[model samples]
Target: MADTAAEAEEKFIAEAKTRVSFVRQTGDALSRDTTVTQLVERMITHLRATVDDPDSPVRPQTIDRYENTVAILRGDYAGGKYPTIGDYPLSEVTEDLVHEWLWDVSVIGPSMGAQCRSAMLRAFDLAKDRGVRLWPVNPAKEAKLKRAPRHIARALTVEERERIIGNVTAWQTPRKRTDLLSIVRMLADTGMRPGEALALRWEDVDLTGAKATVTVSGTVVELKGKRADGKGIRRQPFGKSDAAYRTLTLSSEATTRLLERRVSASSYLVFPNDVGGVLSLRNIGTRWRKARGAEFDGVTLYDLRRTVATELDRKYGPAAAAAQLGHTSPAITGRHYIERATVVGDFTDALGTLR
Candidate 1:
């Protein structure tokens, strides 16, 4: 697998398996049924070139996802994995082929394998429209992916959260890098994503009236650049879904901190660099790592959101927790954000019973 290795290559398939597994129909020529039209049709072409509708163009993210799925399914183009699979006729493709390919990908993780399966289904739907009916049913649809153990959101204790923020508070004004700590606190207070916190503006925050709320309307998204996709930045609503664009009630701590650090009307972004430009997420992360050091290695900005979400779940229940986190469903929040380790019963009642 590499330049130097001490171990033998682990073989997945047995040499003398009774049932047929992977069949390489190399150099197989398609029967000339409709001259030029039949020769050009392929899964790769539909994914890369074919437009979904006359009016609505395919989303750029869709293209990126399909390309990745194609790489995993058909393998590399310039010779690697199983390059020849791309050339296989849509009519020749089968469920067994997709299952085996996805099985290979499952080694990475179940989520990845599941996503690949869905991508293949989309590609094959294009094939269906093209009249390339392999079997009576769509082959890609048959591929099943079992759910693996997913990593739940990591939450910090109240002391851990305070201690980290306390460290950040030491750095004073005019110092630009110290802004990372403020952003960290904002994430904890509002449960806004790191990018959302970075993309925040002074106008979005309301420091007056009976209630203080920050309108989380936009987030920093990296779209398709000149080189590749998902590279450029833009302040856009609905970074992931319609639910992402939401208004969150700022905690008293958050309100106080934000009020102190509110920039002038001339500057728009709440957390800008020295030149009033947006600070990059990576740079902020580096500062956070240094602030936490070895004591909080695994904790992240998302974990700060997790901490807030856990408290939300405790106080208000799942619905409130989901709304605050901009989750479309309570299930996602319930699955990831809700901490399972703590006791849930009435503590006062339990104390009385203990007495």
Candidate 2:
């Protein structure tokens, strides 16, 4: 009787182990079969990271923009079918869906569509990286944009730059507007973004140095328009690439101008608002609009950045231009920011000479 009981007990244990093994196999299968919704949720969660910069989290403005792309996929702003692309199966999602979505948003504007497509492509690529098998291929790879979207085409002419400076200088007041004229001039000369220029501390400027240097590290921005995570931070953190941190040597003319325009602000910013808050983009825009008086369509403070890019590209080629602009790759400066080939003289003369 004892031997029979032991044999029964051993058999029962073996059966239980078999059942556990089967359950484990089932779980492995289930894990591999993650749904499309699960994959995208993973993608979204993963993207909420500091990919933009190493110093801090992704800039809030950028997060909002990324979220907007998700919204675009969901048929939010820039209308498309409800229960949109996100509702579909992962393997089932085709290039056609991406192309269609791009086309759908194009009705709103090419720029909006381009931004949406670009964002979606990034997410999809991320999903593939996470072992999701989210797509056999990135559909966006084949989806060609029919026409290039209109971008900022022209740099500010010297006369236009002078006029903007003159206007800003004439329109300033103790409270209404302050120090914007000097900031504009600095941007043109040094290729600093307005935000970078505004965030500059007096200590960061070395007027005493033989080559006047402005450290291009910090950026100032109002928090209201950006993502929640970006709020409460006084200065927008620098984005990825160590190249963003560098010393920019100012021209003799720029150095002289900076010294003349420098002020002792309580905020210690080289350029500050009347009350010494970082000069906001909103304030700058309001003042520029009023100063220009006419429809100076397409002219903005950022154009000054482009103006500097054009000058650098002209003087030193794209690689040197990229270095001055603090880009790790010259391709970015050459492709996006720097203006291509100046039309110096009549091509007809060159052609005749060649003949």
Candidate 3:
């Protein structure tokens, strides 16, 4: 009887061990299902949802920057290309991991690198708040390298501006020529960013008052990848830069040109493509290049805005210019409008009172 009892006890112990092994195997399978890619996707969705919540301190733009960084990581992973982080687990993310990631590979430019670093830092911060024990430190803070200086605003010179305008008129297609000219003139006159100008609809224009306002509250920005609901385009709204959202007055010529362009209106856009869709920045650059025959050295569509700001400063004082240009303060106006000694010298002479 004793021998039989001992044998029974041994068999029971063996069965318990088998059950424990099976449980561990099931847990391992579950863990395998939650990949780094899956974790990142969930984290991004969660972050975006929380961005506008009153409890969240992060701004919308801040969230965008983070989303863009994760997108880059996702691309690298899917393409079998390695970012600085390689195939490390997201749960093991740390400042040291980020540091290695930034300097590890040479796929990104300096500006992009800095942007990615900023985005990652925000993501880690969000993760910490969400009770994720992943990152012990903010890698961006620990990074020793200084990012490149902010791009200097390049405004067209008076001569260059005239050349660009002249070239716009020389286009073979009258409608195309008119559209390009109108866009250039409006930007130069009003100091509005290209995106802001493109976002304008006919309803936004107040020709009767000779003024227009850019309602940055819900301005659309185009994005790539799968559409929301797998249908149509994806666009997002402008963030909380007060200067980015403001009213602008039109020059008499600009108002007249807009009025003239309205005759062919098939759409609400003040500057629409031939198909009557929103004018794209890429198309603008292409047309501008074709019109000028020669690209303006170091100038972009944004330079038109800078040119307007500089012109405003020359016509009025710096403070007045700042207000007209929708700058946050006079200091910003002075910093951007005050060009090199040679450029400022010409403006000074032009604005100088006859003594």
lDDT leader: 2
Candidate 1 lDDT over residue span 224-317, tens digit each: 4542442555555444667988888877877777777774434688887767766777777787787765677777778888887889898999
Span of 10 residues, lowest total lDDT, candidate 1: 18-27
lDDT string for model 2 (1-355, tens) is 2379889899777756754553353332212345434444444454444445445434555555656556655667546532346566666667887777567665556666666666666656655544445556886666655455546436777888777777777776666556666777788788776777777888788988778998877787554333465553256546235786778998999888878767444677778767775677777777777765475655777677777877888888877777777788988777667666656876796698885
Candidate 3 lDDT score at position 277: 63
Comparison by lDDT, 1 against 3, better one: 1
TM-score per prediction, in order, is: 0.72, 0.71, 0.70
- The clash numbers for all candidates, in the given order, read 0, 1, 1
What lDDT is obtained when candidate 2 is compared to the true structure?
Answer: 0.66
Q: In terms of lDDT, which candidate is stronger, 1 or 2?
A: 2
Worst lDDT run of 10 residues, candidate 2, spans 22-31
Stretches of model 2 off by over 4 angstroms after superposition = 1-42, 49-60, 78-83, 125-131, 150-152, 221-234, 239-241, 260-263, 329-331, 334-355
Rank candidates, lDDT, best first. 2, 1, 3
